[model samples]
Target: MLKTLYKGFILSYLLITISCTTNQNSSDLIQAIDNRQTDKALRIIDQLDNLNEQDSLGLSPMHWAAKRALPQITKALIKKGCNLNITDVHGYTPLNYAIKADNAEIINLMLKNQAVVYKNGLSNLSDGPFVDWTEKGLYAYYLKHDSISSKSFLLGKFINQNTRYFKGWNGDTTTYTITDNKIPAWEFKTQEPIFVLGDIHGQYDRMVKNLQAHGVIDKHLKWSWGKGHLVFVGDIFDRGNKVTEALWLIYKLEQEADKTGGKVHMSFGNHELMVLNKDNRYIANDYKNLCNNLGLEYNTLFHSNSVLGEWLRSKNSMTKINDILFVHGGISQKQIDSGMSTQEINELVRQYLISGSSPKNQDKLNQILKSFGPFWYRGYFMDRSQYKKITEQELISILEALKVSRVVVGHTENDELSALYNGKVIDVNIPLAEDSIPNQALLIKYGKFFRLTEDGNKTLLN
Candidate 1:
């Protein structure tokens, strides 16, 4: 009895020892792959019994190897009996990671290994990561075959603003088209009434009703506010779906408004910046599938090659109409210290999006991408204690330095339009997704400011 007990205890101890060693080896393997220390990684990987072990995020060694395009490491794992068909928490296989890396060589290698992938580029919201759209499409049928299931979004299936329908996909076409012409803007010196609306947040009905009531759009959703400057101060994507519908409407209005000497502008919002940088948490699935069909990520969909990407990338984080500065998020003193003029800032941002964010301008780019940058500054609205506090004089000084009488911003949501810093800072970010009531817009005629509601009523903010 004593000898039997000793043997069982020794066996249990060996199993625990092996488990601990294997876990450590798996972590070390991942680091070596990421650090390009292939030699050390190979040493550690040889000690592992399980090659398909996932991290807390459900990414295995194979996923990392594929993302890094380490062909040798990938092959070694395959030889060691790693499952190529295993999906991560987001349902992305190694094939998806390879597609994101844009490594055609790795993709071919995976194909050679008989790798299978998810269908339709679809994943349940409750599942893993949203479609990992890099400059390339999602899993399977990418540039492989026509008549793919992903093309369903490209048809006339999408609902647009509850009034119009959009035909997304066409069989055998290089570019898809919407049936309407419209587009997105802001002001000039000493001229038309400048209309600034705050965050749309995919509430199409609220946007249209407010615009139509204010004579911005007719019942048909055409640009009716002729020669008027209309601006969406940012946060037009995410939360509710219909982002594609909202964006298309803005695009169509931009074209129509330009024809009649009017302007439609979308200032850079943080949400837009986030999506442009590839955070797809709030991204609509239909949008993702469409992005897949085009062999592009959500960001690259509006890349320099695509007209929509060009237009969106060309938009400024901050704009000046006469003197009042309009930005999606407020600008800080730090943004000014970057020593970039508004035009220069816009150019820099455009350059960053078109070209990859490289090392040379990385510092400047990092500063701009920070929370305090123009499209993300909350110092002006948040209680100075929590974020950063500014005296009224300090606020005026900041505006004066930029040569603006007042500043208009969206992002800091309030129950209604608000005038802070004695009207020097006008926050137009109303709660669009929450309130059923149609919202108001900030109207500037000459130098005076007023809140214009959807009921044709006006409230003096001065």
Candidate 2:
């Protein structure tokens, strides 16, 4: 009886010793892997008395290595005969852990070793989450499998049309073919030339009333008067609540005129140039929020530095209709003396329009801005009192130098309606105040002799 009892004691001691040894090895191996000590983890795994021992976290050293993305350690454990399909508390096998880590290297190694791709040794189609897993996960898996082909497709898609990637700032070379299917031919010249006025700062509701009194807008929003040809001097952006509505109506009219046998000519205004030039310092208080809402990065839009600025630089300063030279601002003697041809002027305008942010030609841009042009020269023409004071001799000399009979401008804020100067120049700064009167636009009708009309009120000025 004593011999049998001693033998049982020895057997129990041996079993406990073996269990403690396995547990200690598993704990040390998992710790090394988790800490990213790849070299130490490999050494610990190799010395393991039992290769299949599970850690306190229920992960084999192999699973820990794969989860931590330690590919070298994972390979060493696999060679030691660690079970690749052994799952943890979360039921994530070594392969699943690798996928979650996004480690393509370890995943390929496991696949090459015939590790299971389908979960629980079952086909993925049998499970619901497996569909999502396979789509996102399997796509990445295949991409890793055939990297060359997948990358090629990605490159091709980047170059596809309708993508914004290629449509970057080049120059005038970037041509936009007139895609508006409603374009009318030049054969549709109206008997009366249209006069489009540009940016009216504030001066709202009053501008509408003036146009209505002039018979431009009837009881309906229809453009009834001034024949079919419509001219809009630009700006139309700052200092008005109905700016968007006004621009929308005008834009609609432009489209309508294009479809019909009519014409619409728009000139660049100083305010438009100001907005384009990022003269935010001069922008009205009401327009600041609207500008932000429209994502108008003025610096990027108008500074001659960018592509758009280059295009703006190329726009014509003014258009000639018979005897009158209608300009946004007014021209100086220097421009006329420069002997620039109409085509050259048009090209310069194109450059101005295209140069996006800051002017590429800084000196030239400054020269143009400082000269008596659309963007500059406000003191001479925009100031009505100044215009009224200038002698006829000075006016005739300037007009003669430019080879024009008369000048029509819209820069000054004329409170007494429109001003007729020396029977040659017309200032149409339709006043905004309630006390102001004769809010009007000068209409020039082309007959054998030119007939000048204020609003619809026709009069002979010659």
lDDT of 2 by residue, 332-434 (tens): 5555555654344544555555553255555445545553544455544434432333456767777886667777666665553343555566655554433
Q: RMSD per prediction, one decimal?
A: 13.9, 18.4
lDDT of 2: 0.51
Model 1 agreement with the true structure over 1-462: per-residue lDDT tens digits: 999999999999999998887878888898888887888777877888788878887888899898888888887888888888688999888877887887766665675465645556444211111111123322112222223422212111223333332233322211223233222223356488878889988777788888888888998888898888888888888775556457767877877887999888788888887887778777766556545533345654443544355556767677787888888878788777777677766767767876868888888888787876888778886655335766788787788788888888988888778788878999898888887644888888866789887777898895
List where candidate 2 sits over 4 angstroms from the true fold. 1-190, 193-199, 202-206, 217-220, 225-227, 290-315, 341-343, 356-364, 379-391, 417-421, 433-438, 446-462
Worst 10 residues of 1 by lDDT: 124-133
lDDT of each: 0.70, 0.51
Q: What TM-score number comes out for model 1?
A: 0.62
Q: Which 10-residue window in model 2 sums to the lowest lDDT?
A: 124-133
Number of the top candidate by lDDT?
A: 1
Clashes of each: 21, 43
Clashes of 1: 21
